[model samples]
Target chain A: MDNIAGHKSGLSWVTNISVVVLVVLWLIPTVGLFVSSFRERDQISVSGWWQAPFSVELTYRTRGDGEVRPVDGGYVMEGNIFDTGEVRSSFEGGASTVSAFGDRGVAPAEYPAGTVAEIGDGETLQVNADGTYIYTSVEEPGNRGPRVYFEAETPPQFTLDNYRNVLTADGMDRAFINTLTVTIPATVIPILIAAFAAYALAWMDFPGRGLLIALVVGLLVVPLQLALVPMLNLHQRLGIGQSFLGIWLAHTGFGLPLAVYLLRNYMVGLPRDIIESAKVDGATDFQLFVKIILPLSFPALAAFAIFQFLWTWNDLLVAKVFLPSDDASKVMTVKIADDLLGSRGGDWGILATAAFVSIAVPLVVFFTMQRFLVRGLLAGSVK
Target chain B: MAPRAGFVSLKGFYMPVIVQGLLTIVIGVGGCIGYFYLSNLLLDKVIFPAKGENAGRNINRANQIRPWLFLFPAIFALGLYLVYPVVGSFWRSLYGRSPSDWVGFDNYVQLAASNEFQQAFFNNLLWVIVVPAMATFLGLLVAQLTDKLSWGNIAKSLIFMPMAISFVGASLIWKFVYANDADIGLINAIRASLGFGNPIDVMQIPFWNNFFLMVILIWIQTGFAMVILSAALRGIPEETIEAAILDGANPWQLFFRIKVPQIMGTIVVVWTTITILVLKVFDIVYTMTGGNFGTEILPSYMMDFMFRDDGRATAVAFIIMIVVLPVMIWNIVQARKEMR
Candidate 1:
């Protein structure tokens, strides 16, 4: 009884703190990728995502590409260090002010910004806060531009270029559509087939029904890895090799055990009086299923649909084994794993954006229908 | 890519993929609806002739045959896709490259003798043992800790978010976390910030790297365990907890003694579910290290041999199936008991 009311004990504080810590620990990795996706490649390489909002120090070694022009007295080679356009995109908000500039490699930031430094060869290098540099030499500088080294403070930058690159340049757009093509039919066909089958199992009196149920329970854990070589060979012989149709059928087969199990369990529990009354009215089993059982079993149907959708959508091995490797047929998971992350492991921008794209759809489905999902998991797993 | 031999070309037709996709769906859904409607119509109107003088007998006959009619497609699909594959894999394991020449148990013998197979076998053993135990333990701890808090659901959802991510996506996320560079990766960035000069390549450390990869699955499956076990905990009878409170049981004693025992059945279910997942763990290792640096498990190893060596690949797959069979039977037995 003492535990019933809120006593405001020290345990409450502990629980609060522990929950905060747990949430942060869980959120860190995913949040890290989300933040990294917006950053430019060089910025992601130079600093951690946690330090993104702070001013970043970037070291650039840029050569003045243009000829040396005589401005006032001495010949001067004048250009901004961020003139390369690649460096300009790193400063997201605006041009970052140069904190320091140096003429030699030993000390790239030897001279402070807005200060003039004298060199031993009568060459002076003066840099402004905006990364614009002025170099004056008493003698005529060579045709080649001098290497101007500067350390500048750049504002944090974010862009959609990574998403652009993945969707257009890396073939993720086609993969997304291919995933949908595989997923829609796979999700739709199983519900109808399983629903009909489940109705029969739940209501009809048939010999070996219990044995068939047991067999399904056994098949639930049958690893689809065993299906790879044999099924591929089967598809090849049947002339359905590596087509969208083949993949849809593969997904349907793999998803059926759970679908039938869940729907049967749900349908078996429906009020028996309704089905008895329908049968008394001389309604056939098909009529009873369509008019009564199907509508009432919406929750179970929804639960199985989400499971199949997420399962088939997230599947990589099935698609890899059953579908052809043509650009037209690759799914997002296969493309992201095999083509993008495999080769461009160091490209965080593309990798993060691509990963997020693949994860986004199922996440939306999960959040929107989490109630049915939780119900399905409990019913499917628990007694 | 090599042009697939002996396959019919659907390329000459210039239909958009979206149109083709929609057409297939229409055909598939239309065919399913058509079959069900026509079959039922025939059963009621033509075959049994329910309106005749022998209506009772005809109805009985249709009822007796109706379940089979409904079950035919599912059975065919299950037989072709699942049961047939199991049998086919066994058959393929007995034959040579082309299946004409016999190689009975020769692939199995060679697999047992190979060093790589041993490495993958031991690594799989490590995963099967460690992932379920760790994930279940963490799930129970989190579920217990977060049960009474105001923000518990939100906290649970945060932990549960990884479940929606594909293994490939999760691998990429964790790879970023375990990135070798000191600047981009979170782990090495923290290390470098703390004055550790050299960054550790976490995926390259043999033996322990398997655990590192297992962490991803653990992270994903813990939320599932938490959601299920949390419900199971709530299902524990209130009188038992109240009685423990009256007996002056402390918090730890209350949880481990009263609560844990009550939900032990659920704990076993969660453990076995995760065990099944860990046995099939492939995509993470495949994407993260491609079985390099001693991170190979059973499935990834089987995939490596799939196109190159048929007999050995089927044998490896059969090995995984054998490993899974006992757990599968245990699951079915538990479910059957629940049914009654």
Candidate 2:
């Protein structure tokens, strides 16, 4: 078409630029979180993630409390500012160079490092680039000593401690295991049940098959919200309420419509003559399904498996409503949404690391099996 | 539980949760396979034995019963899980807080009178209108723009990457983007650079804040729309495009006049699919604002009453079902038409 068309070549630059813009726009949000997860907590609070690679200048207030000595015509207090307990505790990284210093908090960076500044009350302050400072006053200093305000340039710092903290202390490790527990059986059981039902709908000569298929399609859009209260009631009555078993069953039910619909659509398109020939060769229905249809339908099965895996893994509502809220059984999405969002809302480092931890598995599954996922999406939705 | 704990101490490498998870998978899958195989074997060998003077009749009977054998577990699960809930929700909605107390339409009356319900209902309306339209339009635009590019597949995958992220995770990601601190929030940082003095809390901006929440969903779903609609675009017959080109249609005309009209069905499919998702969106609003500052939608509002008032919760659930009913019917109709 492009060879026959003249304007398309002339407009090719427009298409390329537009796509570049779209891709960048789509990639920014997730990239923001991913980058934030690696930064130190103080760095995340003090600077934007986009500025993470550059050095940051921060001001700190500390008092020189070292023993005062009587010098010629003055009293002097000398110490390394970076070695003070306040600076060591407040600063993030190991090595920091003093950029500027001042005697008053109002003008914290009034004089550059390696210079001496004179005060009106016969006092002088000097802070070198090595973080060593000297304070000389004509009058004897009080026990509090002179207050020194200095700005320092700290190098870019990143750590894996955020990941460690959430995984161990915040119960995300437990949540990760619990999510796997909920997702595995929930993803597997539906495939088995839906496969058999789909085989029956596709190959068997049964009454009400058309109506059944239509029923499945109608049930496809039934909001899972309709199931919550009633299902919880039923689960309590049946003595399976708020357990892994209960949530598994709930996910299986909620997932069935799409499983059956996608599988049935794919099965109905199988080579009819092959099925007929197998039947003519005296194969029983069960044998025929296990031996022939199931094997030939691997692509469709793989597609549905990927869909159910991603859906169940990324699910929050079903897990929240059906599973026990105890720490022992909390899934990742529930943990992140409830615990992290509530208490650690301002802790971007922990929040970002936890979110990434929960998102990592599904993303791996999605990229590795994206071909099957795409095929499943097309077959499931587009008629 | 004690034995599992003891075993955990005995074998220091094994976590009890991981052990339980592995056991569940094996048992759940094994149980399903065993049930299917045993039930089918029983139907063939015991109830309708195939080797006798009545072999033909028995075989025919078994064949008639075999389909049900394959479908029984699925039917039981579907009926128990889905079909029973719809009816049970309506029944529960008719009663008051106590199940035995009959309070017909009282919950609905109170819901109608409540200001929060009205606000949530209106917010949901805004979501239904805005989210699907923006996501679909952006998706279609990306699909069209990237179609002719050499690296189109990579571009599509990147756009679609958000589909893998859970809504809770996406909300957290967007929270950082919309943080109130100018140093941390991307939007506020840009604003500060432009000389805005104070950092505004975007989520507390009343009605307009709803659009900010909707942007997170649009960001996540645009890839889904792109994937589905891109396939639809490729499925278009090339003859129609070439004929329009020969007819001297400009690029915009070729797209709007020649291409879009052909894939309108698919566009509607993508639109309605996203609309249904928008209706059920809960995690974003719940995690981001907890439905505070007038960002309540239906699902999160129902969650508020879930434990405290069963009747009210079911009432909200029933309303959501009612809202979804038309789309459900439309989906079935489209599916039936395709079957024909």
Candidate 3:
């Protein structure tokens, strides 16, 4: 018994370790973007985002101002290694604090930041904390200045500049509002209409209910891409082309199958007794639905609402097809891809910030109402 | 008059586009609400006049008509937006680019003969196979692993976080990981640290880049699989596991022989649901590679032809529908069975 228990516990340890490893692996990509969004290109280029929380080593080279002049009885030229005037200029600029310096190419940080290291031939290199360095050598070091190797400790940096740039300059703010414009009505209208349909399917003794339910199920997997060109052509011919009204109706039509399916399933699960008793009490079907059914079906409605909201909000293809390609009408997903991701694909900060901005709302919705979201997923799929 | 003749006049009315948008919402939602409410009222009060002689008979007639009144708006929208377009696309597929040219099977022939179409068809096949299986497997694995731990919910939440992110957003996130700059891309950074020289642009490579794009979907979908399968895992009765343990079965044996057999239904559900998603996958390929370098899938391929070749685009759309039809029919069957 003891041997078996020991092996079982060992297996659990493996489980725990593997879960942690999997979670970290899953988080690494997003975390990389999250960190990269707060950093400058220079810092991002020099080191990994994992090193963001700690001090990073950086190297800088300053040109020599080697002018032959007499200083302390030797021909010498002196200047700060930072080239930005005083040593404090480097510190003030938020660069890594100089920790070590080197006079020779071999070891840049061989000497500490404040001390003077003497090479042969009356040449001495002195670097101070404020990045001011005095290189003393005879005969102007042959009209060439020594290349002072600078190694500094750059403190971890985090900034909101990327967010500011994305929101203001990259037009994400307008897209955010435009997305909201499409999402609200798209989400609400479908729920209202689908609720009626769902209620009818759930409770009403309709002849085609079985066939309608099956139709909804079959339509569930029909790729909206199939509907794209044809719908656009219809919209153009009907004069609703590239309009918000057009996109809303598109979202509504696409969202209805899942909405009706989920709501009808939830409504069907309502205790038969309550509905029967309500009907017997002389409450009309419409009145019972408005009062009893709608209230009781809040959780399901909420789940579907979140699903619709996230679907509409995170949607790119629907917006691409239905909404105008013009910037003024584009939603955040489309706008971000068009303005930032396309032209400045290499600008990690802009891309990360824009991507994060676009996803932030759905993330908030997903976390705050995750219970309903999961409920929706389970009911929507499994049934 | 045509059915959308009223909409034709509304579309031509002069107004700011935003006002027109708000008006549409008011008109559209208001129209649906008004239709259901007024239609019911009309049926009860005006058409049937339930309070007159033979009131009970009048009420019966109104009751019989109420469900249709409630269902009319939804049916109209679905027919106009979904049903009509489906039939229209099929019809459109028979004609050439201008829709005036009478082309019989020419579009399908072109789609079958084109090199890009063949690559897209096969690549889509690869995606449909690989994404669903791998995502479901990983999800089941995570669900099983996390179920044994105390902090499982947190782990699950973190793993599931990608679900909230859009495919475009996810593509961007993974783009950073697959970045060609050794200093920027996390994958390349790790590679460089291990002395792998300069970064290799993973997306530029043919064939393998398709898998790189598929990883984004698997990343997003695994959480969905985990959540559903986790619920299924918990649904397993305790007596089954206890009896297996009593029989001195190992953990692996307990999982495969006991747990898996019980949850096979949920596993299939997750697999097919993901398969449906895989068929419609566009944004990942659209944003990541734009169907270039042999990464083209059917949806992206269709999208490329959408602006130019209407027949070919519609033909591609039909091809996608054909691929999705079997699973869709299976889905409906399963749903009907569940309903029963």
Best by lDDT: 2
Q: Candidate 1 residues B178-291, lDDT tens each? A: 999888777888899899999999999878989999998998999999999999999999999998888888787889999999999999989988988887768999999999
Evaluate every candidate with DockQ and list the scores.
0.57, 0.57, 0.45
What is the C-alpha lDDT profile of model 1 across A19-66, one tens digit per residue? 788778888888988899899887888888888887688787766665
Docking class of 2: medium
Q: Extract clashing residue pairs from model 2.
A: none
Worst 10 residues of 2 chain A by lDDT: A86-95
Local distance difference test, candidate 1: 0.85
Error of 1 at A375 (Å): 0.6
Clashes of each: 1, 0, 6
lDDT, model 1, position B223: 93
What are the per-model C-alpha RMSD values against the true structure?
3.0, 2.9, 5.2
Per-candidate TM-scores read: 0.94, 0.94, 0.89
For A243-339, candidate 2 gives per-residue lDDT tens digits of 7778878888998989999898899999999989999999888888889888988888899888887888888888888876766777899999999
DockQ of 1: 0.57
Ranking of models by lDDT: 2, 1, 3
Runs in model 3 deviating more than 4 A are: A1-8, A56-90, A93-130, A133-153, B1-30
Worst lDDT run of 10 residues, candidate 2 chain B, spans B1-10
